[model samples]
Target: MLRTIRRAAFDQARTQLLSPLSLLAALAMPCVFAFVLHSFAPGRTTPDMAVGIAGIGMLNAVIVDLLGAMSKEKVWRTLYPALGSPGGLVPVVLGRLAGIAAQALVSLPGTLLVLVLAWGISPDFDWFRWLAGGLLLAIATTAVVGLLAYFLLRFPSSPGMTNGLTGILIALSALLVPNAALPAVVQPIAWLIPQSHVMAWTRGGDIPQILIALGQVVVFSAVVLASLRRLERIAREQSVPLEY
Candidate 1:
């Protein structure tokens, strides 16, 4: 299982890192957003903004890129072999998503550099808090992306679906704005997003919030694994073509 996962991760990471467009989207776009945001409000760029920008980059990397890859695999009819592998779809998908999640980490330094250079803002960088929160956020986001892939792969004709879902998640992530600033109705929904709690923990170093975020990751991961098993079973039982 570990070998299978490592191979899948390596393959996915190699493919993504080799793509100029993926690099631009995952690394360059965050810096651009940071520059634009700082330009708009000069001195008002907060550490939270840095986190938000990096979070957006991470989301784009994991959600957009992962879904796009899955869609391409579906079109090329290449995922069929992986589905029939001994480890099946869950470990392969999880490992591939892990590779994308790891790639998303580049956004952190990119965002930090832009904040320091463009806005003259030095955030009180807490490595422990950031790493803990980031790890949990990555896990939760990967699970969510995996879940989305299950649906999106079934309907590969909708090319914009990934972007649309990514946009909605970013809005609800509390990365751009404070949770308190969101409307009352939206506030509750924002808390449900893993990034909201992860951001809260990152900014304030709140233990309970991180714990809640961990719990959310656990739940979401379980759902993703279950969904993958069911998807595989359905494909086998109904003779559904996964590469359609």
Candidate 2:
């Protein structure tokens, strides 16, 4: 299983990270947006936006990679065998995500460097805190990845719908601004988003807040996994063909 996961991860890394254009966009767009926000937003808000944007960019890139990995088997008309293989498809999907996560980690430092050099902003925490913060971000993002994977498996052909939903999640998250600045109705919604906890943590929220984020992540992941199981069952029964 570990070997399968590693191979899947490696394949995912090559397919997504080796694309020069995608890599360029992933590395450049966050810095560009940060520069714009720094120019326009009040000085006090720049750091918050910088962290939010960097986190968003990293998660966004990896989530897209996961989606691609999920779809590739279907694209190649190999979904049936892949899913029917020993230990089922979950491990395979996770293996692919391990690779995607690796790529995201590789790109993150450059993104942070851009934040520091170009936007004049970066997280100012001790090493341990930074590690904890990264864990929180990963937990939150894995929850999201689970949700998005459910969607991808549920509607294998509708990449646009999945992409649109991803956009909506980002909008509801603290990636754009502080949750307090969001409308009252949206604030509750933001709490349910993993990225919201990330924003709060970035701004120095305490351990209790981290607990809440961890809880949300666990709940979201559980729900997503259950849904994926059902989707896999249905797909196997219906024998859904390769979807272009």
Clashes of 2: 0
Residue 205, candidate 1: C-alpha displacement in angstroms? 4.6
Tens digit of lDDT per residue, candidate 1, span 100-172? 8887777777666766776665455556665565566666667666677678655545646655776778778
For candidate 1, give the lDDT of residue 82: 69
Query: Against the unseen true structure, what C-alpha lDDT does each candidate score?
Result: 0.73, 0.65
Alpha-carbon TM-score of each model against the true structure: 0.89, 0.83
How far residue 146's Cα lies from its native spot in candidate 1, in Å, is 2.2
> What total of clashing residue pairs does each candidate reach?
0, 0
Residue pairs in candidate 2 whose N, alpha carbon or C atoms collide under 3 angstroms: none
| Candidate 1: 10-residue stretch with minimal lDDT | 154-163
In candidate 2, stretches whose alpha carbon ends up further than 4 angstroms from where it belongs are: 42-50, 119-131, 156-159, 242-244
